[model samples]
Target chain A: MSVLVFIDHSAGQIKKSSLEALCYGAALAASTGTTAEGILLGTVSQDLSELGCYGIGKIHQVASDTLNNLDARVFSTVLAEAVRSTGANIIVFSNNLSGKAIAPRLSARLKAGLVSGAIDLPQVANGFTVRKTVFSGKAFANVSIHTEIKIITLNQNAFPLTAGQGTAQVIPLDIKAAAPDVKTVSATQSSGQVPLTEAEIVVSGGRGLKGPENWGMVEELARVLGAATACSRPVADAHWRPHNEHVGQTGIAIAPNLYIAIGISGAIQHLAGVNRSKVIVVINQDPEAPFFKAADYGIVGDAFVVVPKIIEAVKQLKGVA
Target chain B: MKILVCISKTPDTTAKIAFKDNNTKFVAEGVQWIINPYDEWYALVRAIELKEKDPATILHLVCVGLPDADPVIRKALALGGDEAIRVNADSQDSYYIAAQIAAVAREGNYDLIFTGKETIDYNGASIGGMVSELLDLPFISLATKFELAGSLATVTREIEGGEQTEQVGLPLVVSCQKGMAEQRIPNMKGIMGARSRPLKVVEPVTADTLTSVVSFELPPAKAGVKLVSADNPAELVRLLHEEAKVF
Candidate 1:
């Protein structure tokens, strides 16, 4: 049985998360004595052979314009057919927006066991057991899939990418595709800012910044640090930032490497989403702010005073004006 | 319009998580249970708002769990759901839960189904998509904003660096998160009314579970905070560069 990894792309380029998934699937294939292959649904600009360095042997490309925009049902049907024809028992996907949308439906269609948010490779010595984060990154659960076909979606940035010198053979697959049930009307493009979910470093602000007018320092720090900008729920709720920028239990959950929170009280809801960050830094005037307890490094000071110095330090460190 | 809101009971956000039985099971003793924040704060609240907008809307609450999950269902009804359905299944497998939900949705012929993006406990985020596929309905996952006008519904969902707005017909499923609606606290009258609302306990459909839990483990704890005085903010950067090595 071979391992099939879903390679997701946007604007004709493969997403970084897909590379992580590719590495994870390759490692799993190596451990299980199976070949690692990939399936691409839409047209991509990247040379399929170059991705061979990630250890994938072959890539099945379905160049359908309709596949460009993700439709969970349509994608599931295509993937189910691919799995049937390829005899791939293990499927892998990145547990991102598209993965979350498609993996579960695909699981239903294939009647396969699925483990989403998997953080580790399966323990295959005795049985195929996968470990995943649950309770909003509070704990891990080891799930054993007994189904003939099993699926796993890896969390973003969970696996390290290992590169090897190699080339992959690309083959085209022809399949009957269906029109999507849902129709897209419009899309608001995000600016050049880093994607919060995929960003390695993030600078977040809460109500402590006081209002939207005081957001300049937060943006400056984020720019200097080369980090994405995020906010607590209250800031978003109060319309100081767009709802999409909110990062918390009720908002987008992110686990960047460096999460710098300025003037934000660390609420449990907020922690549920960001507790997985590699290192947390909090800057607040109140020393008793609960965020300090969860942070690796903390500064008890006013945001107005603390953020500029951090930004200046970053600029000086990076040799920028 | 008929809507089915899916809910689950989860440990409170601050609950001290512990595993028992050699880490084979999650310890429930002395744990405070509440309606999953996402379910109560987003999906159910949005369904209630839609019902308020149009009196013709009928809201139903569904959960796949044992009898102990009834209180969670009651809380949903108290928050404005008209009726509730509890599928007596103990398995936390998404396939099993989706099978049970699909059966009920088929029996009820509900037009719109809403579920939280994922339960906080399992964080599987799979049931809505699985159930939609099972029922052969359109599935929209991680919908932040949902609005209905006549038979067509408009939705806005998040992408990596952007957002996409889409439109779909009725009889679809959506996994909801923030921006859909605000939270609703159950008032005295609503709580009183929930006590009388009918909660039907149904049997689950026969389905094979694809996965089983081998164990539950906790993530490594964070080291105590290392404070860097705000006056010397450059030192914080030094530690991040020299020690944390994140930059």
Candidate 2:
């Protein structure tokens, strides 16, 4: 029996979270005395063989044009069948949108013990136990799964990717496709420089930005750093930024590597989503902002002046003209 | 359109978070329990919107709690819900709560189930997903906006750095978030009307629980903030590199 890793893709390219999940699954498989394989659904344009560097021995590609879109039920059904066919004893996924939708259903279907938001490798001393964040990253919980098959959804940025010199065997798999009951009529997207969830660095603005017109510096800095842009809930509600850019308790919960908050007094609601960041930097002229209490680093400054200078310096550092 | 909106009764946001006599349980003395704020935004408001589109639509507010939560359930009824259901059971675990809701959904023959992305109290975003699994239906979490037309529902969810639009068929579960609708306060007329609406309290069937919380504790306090001079932006950057090691 082997460990199965689900590779997430969008716009015909694989996601960085998938690579992290692949490495996590590979490491878990090694500890469990089993081999790790990967499954790629939909039509991917990337070189599937290159995934071998993460220690994946083979890739099962379900190359169907219809599979490009997401239908949780359909995806769960197809993935369950794939697991049975491959004799995979453990299933792994990135603790993401698709993973959140599919893993629970798959767990119930297969009667396998499941865990999400797993932050570390499983402890196999006596029984298989995995560590996960609970209470909105406020604390950690150790959960032990006592099923014949195990499933885990790794949190984003929780595990680092491993690179090595090897080529993985890309073996295509034949699976039955189910008809999706849902159809997309129109999709409205927010055009931006960085994808917030995938960005290594995030530059967020809050009420301190003052008005929508003053957002240029935040965008310029994010652009220079190749980081995604985010806003506190109040900023989004005021329409300074689109609703999709809102990151907080009521908004999108994120766990990027570096999170920089500007002009924002961190509320408990706002902190719930971003407290998981590896390093948090708060920039607010008010030295007493609550955000500074939780920030790993704090800079007392005015965004209007400090942001422009930071952007210019970043551009100069990156030599991006 | 029949919509089932689920709300959880919890302590008010302003309530002081603390432990009880032995620092094991949440302090509940004199704490006012209100409908979870997130659920009100994502579920109740969206349900009202659906009702406005189709006046014939049936909107039911549901909760799994004891009799003391009836006032909050009545408050939900006053907020335009035609009916309310009290499961008469404490939501001890996610699995048990999901089983109770799944049973109710099956019996009601509801087409769509709506809940907050996660309850502020338990914060177990698990029920909606688990309920969908038990009911054998599609589930979507953290939907910023959703539109239902011609038996197909399209939902947009915020992902890490980006957003994704998903289309799913009818008879699905959706966990609503901000942007679904603005919070609505109950008017005097609605409050009077709620007095006569049907509020049913039923006992919950015993469900097999797979997990239990052995203890609870508060998160450790964050370290004190280190202030950096704003005059030298370069100094701040240097400190991030040499001291914080984050750069």
Candidate 3:
């Protein structure tokens, strides 16, 4: 049996997380002594063969316009059919927005075991077991999949994206597309910003920023550092930032290469979301802020004064005016 | 309209997380449990708002847990659910839990189904999709806004870069998140009323437990933080560049 990776794309562009998923699937397939193949449901503008650099040997494409927008029910139906036709025993997905919507449905359709938020490769020498984050990254669990057909959704940024030399053979799969019951009324795309999930660096602020008007410094620092801007729950609740920017246990959980928290007290709920970052930097006025304990570096300072200096320093380092 | 909102009980957000039984089980001792925030703040509250608009809307709460989870279910009922159902099973398997919810939904003939995007404990973000698939119904996940007119539902859900608004027919499932509705605390009157509300305990339908936890591990403790003088922002930047190499 072969391993199948769901190559998720939006507006004809493949997501960065899917690249990691492809790499992960390829490695898993190699370990199991089987080839890794990719399944693309919607049409994309990029050359599908180029994706082979990520180690996939083949791509099963169902190029249909109707499959472009996410309709979990319709997508799952098509994927389930593909899995049966391709004889794929292990399915891989990047646990992003689209994957989160679709993977569990696929598992149910196939009666396969699913482990979402998987952080590492499965151990196959013994029974197949996958390590995944539980309790919102506070704890980890090694879950064994008993079902013959297994499914896993890899956490974004958890797996490194490795590219090597290969060309994927693109084979068109003939499968009738299901008419989507969910009609897309409209879409408002966030343009000209690195999406939080895919961002390598994130600069977040809490109530210490004081108000929405003072967000200029935060944005300036983020812009200079080429990082995405995020916020704490209180800031989002107070309308200092949009709810989408909230990153915490109750909000979006992000694991970036570097996460800078300004003015945040680092409540347990807040730490639960961002504890997985590779390195954390905390800048706050209060020395007793709980965030300092979890941080890799701490600067006890006022956001108004410290942020602008950091911005200037970053700009100087990047040779940006 | 009949709405079924799935609720889950999880450890309190501030509870001390630890393991028992050689790290195979979560330490439940002295751990206070609460209704998962996503379920209480978004899913059930949105259903309550809908019921407020349409007086005839029947709101039913469902949970897959043992009797220990009853208090959480009762709290959900106090929040606004007219009735509640608890599947008497204490399993951590998401597939089996979804199967139990699907069984209840199939028998109830619900017009709308709501679930939080994910539980605070496992953070699986899985149940709604699995339940919808098992029931063969359209599923909209991470819905931030939901509006219903007749049998057509207009839902706005969060995507990777932005937001997308879509319309679906009734008898669909939705996983609610922030912006769907504000969190509501049960009033004394509501809490008293919940005492008399019908709480049904039903036997779980047999479903395969596809996965089992072999072991648990806590994240490694962080090394002590390296403090920098507030006036020395440049030094901090240099350290991040040279030491962390994050840039």
Candidate 4:
């Protein structure tokens, strides 16, 4: 029996979360004394074998044009068939949007015990048991799976990426493709300088930016840091930024490695979506901003003056100019 | 359209979380239970929206809980749902809950199933997807905006860096999040109508469960915040390096 990892991708490119899941799956397989393999759906130009550096032994590709876009039902059905065909006892996926949609379906199809938002590998001294976060990252629960097969969706940033020296065997799977009941006629992609979810660092502003015209400093700092830009709900609601850029309980949730918030009071609703960041630096002029309570680092200074200085410092530190 | 909305009772967001019985279970002494916030925002609001679009549409509310959960179910009915179903079995696991929901959906012949992106209580976000798999239907999650035209439904979801819009056929499952629809307060008429609506309580069909919760535990207490004077931003940086050691 093998461990199967689903590689999430879009528009012919793999997502960073996929790599994190790959490492997680590889580690789990090591503990269980089983080989870790991966399954890639759709067509991508990236070399699948190169990802073997993540410590997988084999990579299975089902390169079909129809599989380019995500269709949860179709992907789950195909993956279920792949599990049976490859004799995989464990399946792994990143706990992102696609993974969240597909993991449960795959579990029901395979009758495997499933865990979502898992923070660590199963404690496998006895029967397999995985620990996951509950209550929106507030608490922990240990769940033991009694089934013969198991599935887990690892939360992104929960596990650090580990690299090894090896190339995986890229074997193309020959399985009958299932037709998708859904069809995508058109997709409206968000046009932005940085993609929020994939960015290593994100510089977000809140009402503290004052108005849309005063956003220049925030943008300058974000550009210097090579980070994506975002806003709180009030900024979005005020139309200072698009609603899509809002990151809060009512907006997109993100967990970047470095999250810098400028001029925003962190409401609980705002905190709910972004509390998972690795390092949070809140740069608000308000020392009393509730976000300061959660920040790992805080700079109580005016964004207008402080952000520009930080940008200059970063550029000098990087020796860019 | 026949839409089924799933709701779960959860602790209020502000409730102080604690553990009892050697940290094996949550302490329930003084906490108040309400409809899961996300479930209320997505499932309840979206159901109301659909009902408004088509007055003939039927909206059913379902939950997996004991008889005491009837008040929560009635609250959902008052929120404009037409009928209610409470699976008599207490949900011991996510799989069992999904099975109960799938059973009801299949029996009711629901064309669409609406659930919150995830319950605030467990935050598993697994039931909607599991039920979709069981029923062999398409599942879309974290939908911000959705519109149904004829037999096709288009949904917009927020992905890592961008947004994706997908169009799928009928008989679909969608896990709703914020922005899918606006929140609504139930009218007095709707509240009165809810009191008279038929709430069918049924036992869940037996299904294989793969997992069980062994224990629950509170997270370790966070170290008290270390504050630096505003004049010394560099001191703040030093604290991150030395005191917190998290930078």
What do the candidate models score in CA lDDT, each in turn?
0.91, 0.81, 0.94, 0.83
Ranking by lDDT: 3, 1, 4, 2
Better of 1 and 4 by TM-score: 1
Model 3 lDDT at residue B117: 96
Better of 1 and 2 by TM-score: 1
TM-score of 1: 0.98
Stretch of 10 with least lDDT, candidate 1 chain A: A248-257
lDDT of 3 by residue, B103-178 (tens): 9999999999999999998888999999999999999999999999999999999988679999999889999999
- The candidate, 2 or 4, that scores higher on DockQ is 4
| Reference-based TM-score of each model | 0.98, 0.91, 0.99, 0.94
Q: iRMS for model 3? A: 0.7
Distance from true location, Cα of A243 in model 1, Å: 1.8
Which candidate tops lDDT?
Answer: 3
Per-residue lDDT of candidate 4, residues B1-247 (tens digit) = 8999999988777666788888778887798887887788777888788789899898889999998788888878888888999999875578889999999999999999999998876878889889998898889888888899977998887676666778888899999887777667778998899999999999879987789888887666444345555555556545544664533
Per-residue lDDT for A66-89 in model 4, tens only?
888788888988898899888999
Instruction: Report how far residue B176 has shifted in candidate 3, in Å.
Output: 0.7
lDDT of 3 at B12: 100
lDDT of 1 by residue, B1-247 (tens): 8999989899988888899899988889999999988888999999999999998899999998999999888888888988999999988788988999999999999999999999889999999999999998899999989999999999999888888999999889999998889887899999999999999999888988889988899988788899999899999998999899998
Error of 4 at B93 (Å): 1.8
Please state the CAPRI-style docking class of candidate 3: high
Model 3 lDDT tens row, A1-321: 999999999988999999999999999998999999999998999999999999999999998889988999999999999999999999999999999999999999999999999999999999999999989989999999999999999999999998999999999998998789899999987788888888999999999988899999888888888899999999999988989999999999999999999999999999999999999999999999999999999999887998899998998999997
- Per-residue lDDT value at A28 in model 1: 97
